[model samples]
Structure formats: C-alpha cells, structure tokens
Target: MTHTLLEGKKGLIVGIANEQSIAWGCARIMRDAGATLAVSYLNEKAKPFVQPLAERVEAPIFMPLDVRSEEQMQSLFQKIEKEWGRLDFLIHSIAFAPKADLHGRVVDSSVGGFTQAMDISCHSLMRLAKGAEPLMRDGGSILTMSYYGAQKVVSNYNMMGPVKAALESSVAYLAVELGPAKIRVNALSPGPIATRAASGLSDLDNLLSVAEGKSPLRHLIDLEDVGNLAAFLASDRARAITGGVHYVDCGYEVVD
Candidate 1:
C-alpha cells in the first residue's frame, strides 16, 4: 500500500457549496492524494449542500465562514490551529459579485457593487492568506482561483474582472511576503467551466460556447483539470514556484 502526492498533509477547502463545486473537485482529489479535509460553508442555508459533500470526502468538519467578516476568518483559523496544530495547505475558492453588477457594463458598475465585488473576490484572498500565515509555520501553500477576464475583456463578467485582477496582484504580493516563511501563494486562472457559481451569472451558457470555440483545445475546462494542477501547486513539487498566476486556460489567453 502506497500513499500519494499529498500524503501526510491536511488542508482547508473553503467555499464549498455543493457536489458540482470547483472546491469540491479540489477537495476530492486532494483527499484522494491523502490529505485530510476541513470545509467552510457560508451560512446555515448552504450547510445541507456543503455538509454531504464534506461527509462524502470524510472531511472532519464544516465550519461557518463568511470571508468578509474578519471575526469569522480569525475564529475559523484558530479552530484549525487548535484541532490540527497547523496547516499544510489552503484553497481560497471564494468569489462573489452581485448579479446586477455582472450584467451591467463595468462603467455602469455602481459604487456598492465595486466595493462588494472587490471585497468578496479579491480582498478575501488577502485576508485568508494573512490569517493562514501563523498556522502555516511548517510552510504551506495558499491557492486561489482566477479567470482570463482578469487579463482581457469578457462580456458580462463586468466588475468581477477587476476584482480578479486585484486578486492576481495580491497573489504576487502575498507570495513575496510569505516566501521567507517557506509558504507559496499562487492562482489558477482557469478557462470557462460550468459550475454552480458560474450559473449565477447572466449569459454564461452562451459565453461558455464562445470559450470552447476560442480555446485551442476546442473544449471547456473541467474541475478535475484544475483540481490536479491545484494539488500539484499545494505540494512540495511547487516548492520553487511562488507568485505565479499559472493558467489552465487551454491557451485561451494566448489568442485573446
């Protein structure tokens, strides 16, 4: 019997909502590789969905976390440290923008939407990275998800593009700052993938078709693809790779 890539490791997979979730894919693969799991769902309303998924993966706990709330961030990681002593990895699979904001032009994006979008999508990454620092004393990887729209125009993505741009920037900054501690920070800028979150935005199905056409592979990205890459980044295989915004976008960024 042989353990695998993530053997002896443990991770916190935040933002899981359901079985179709990107975080759920990452959670499944990482667990398969032998890392233990802790999940974080936003509220009571989301608990039923997140709980069963966590149970399926043998995740020990599913705590409440709303990243916008600093109290929740601190309390959540404190629980991790108390129970697990420290962490080996963390996935910030959270991002949000109001539906109205996603439908409107960026120029038409309001002050509230801009604040909420950036706060939830970008700043939350920064906050989580900082919170994870102390408990990552043995050195850990912090990974976040981004999209091509952060670099180029993607209609109806609207304010989220800017939020992701800020997120990518934060990845660089956090990587450099956490380097001496032996922690890595990076992002996976994935191409279009159908998930519960993506379905929330308007015109996504049509846009996904366009993504398939533009992608060199002539196909869409999948949670498994992103999951494999994420596990690699969170492991010692990526020891020297920090501050990188790695793309799993099927070369879609190349053309556009």
Candidate 2:
C-alpha cells in the first residue's frame, strides 16, 4: 500500500459503475499510488453512480464518454488534452451485450446484438487507444478487462466468449502496433466476481461455487486483489510487460 509507483502519472479510468466495479477498484489503487486521475461516466444515468467514487479519488476531470458516440469520446479526450496535457495510463473496463444476445446461444444471436456486443466490448478499446496515443507523448500503458470464457467455453457465457476472445486478440495486435512508441497494451483476465456485470450472466452462483472448488486458492478473488495487480501493471515495475493476457483468476484457468 506504500507504493509510490505512479506518483507522477496521469491516467483515465472508464466504465466505473459503482464502488463494486472493477474499474473503480483500479481507480482507487491508482489514486492511492499517487496518480492524477480522470474518469468517465457512461451517460447521465451513470453519472450518479460514478460521481461519489470520482470525488473519493479526487479526479480533476470527470466527463461523459459513450464509446459508441464519436462526438462524446472525442470531447472526453479533448478535455483530457486540455487539462492534463498528457496521459500516462488508461484502464478500460467496459463491456455490454443486450440481454437476449448475452443469454442466448452464439448461433441464435441477432446481427444487431452481435455487432453491438463486439463494438462496445471489443472495438472500443481500439478507439480509445487511437485517441490516447497522440497524448501519450512519452509512452504509456493500456489495460482492458477480460475473462476466462474468452479462451475456453464456459456454460452460460454465450456470445461474450467470442467477443472477449476478439478483445484479447486486439490487445496483442495493438501492443505490437504501439510498442514502438513505448505504449504497452495488455488484457487482464480476472476470475468471476459478483460484479454488476456478472449479474447478467446466467447461473453465476453455480459458476462461482464451481470456481472456488476448482481454483488452487479455493476462494474467489476480490476487488483488492484486482486493484493490486492493476496497480503493478500500470506502474514502471511492469514497463517490460505488454501484449499479454495476464490472468488474475486464482488458478481457476489451470483446472480441468
């Protein structure tokens, strides 16, 4: 907790819904490590949920960013450019799928649903990276949230499996493209937690139970564990690490 690894860094944290959000966890840790932070609320509806947390982190620039809207995303970055003048790190913890597409089989998913899922969950990272690149004058780190389902099938994971797979692949490709600028990209694949997002998945209680039994740690991971890892990756300690899908899943991926 005494690490001043990011003392002089400036970062953007997107997709915090509430205190329980993974993005919130990363934000708190990044703030504690002494980084100046900026945060985005998805819209007016999400603003209430994110405001208090932003205050807690003392973020100077809080703005609205809906990745689907080029205007909104541009405005958010424009604000960043005006305020911070540069960006050192970014954490993308956003993903979404219409309930129908999320609950149904991949083959049964509608084109609209599939496209929306891919756009929000996978492609938005690319959009954000493009905007952040020019501002990362010295170099930076980009981290996105992912899950085990992206690699192997998990019952009830449905269409998101493919979506997250695409996300992880994007991390690899983006890392290669950005490496020359010293902009590192990585995907953090966390184990299931009872986050608001996970509540959308079918039979999540069973998944958690099974994961606990299967994982080497024998207990589910929590936000703090996630925060610790995220802080490390964003810090200079991880300067050499990039283009990897690092797991914070309590060894569950190794089981079976």
Which digits, one per residue and each the tens of the lDDT, describe model 2 over residues 118-206?
99999999999999999999999999999999999999999999999999999999999999999999999999999999999999999
Prediction 1 TM-score vs. true? 0.96
Give the CA lDDT, 0 to 100, for residue 29 in model 2: 86
lDDT, candidates in the order shown: 0.88, 0.94
Runs of candidate 2 with Cα error greater than 4 angstroms are none
**Which has the greatest TM-score?**
2
Residue-by-residue lDDT tens digits, candidate 1, 1-256: 1248899898999988888788988998898888898899999999988888888889875689998778888888888888899899999988888888877888899899889988888888888888889889989999999988888878878788888999999999999899999999999988888888889778989989988898889988888888898999988888999999999978888885
**Cα shift from native, residue 112, model 1 (Å):** 1.2
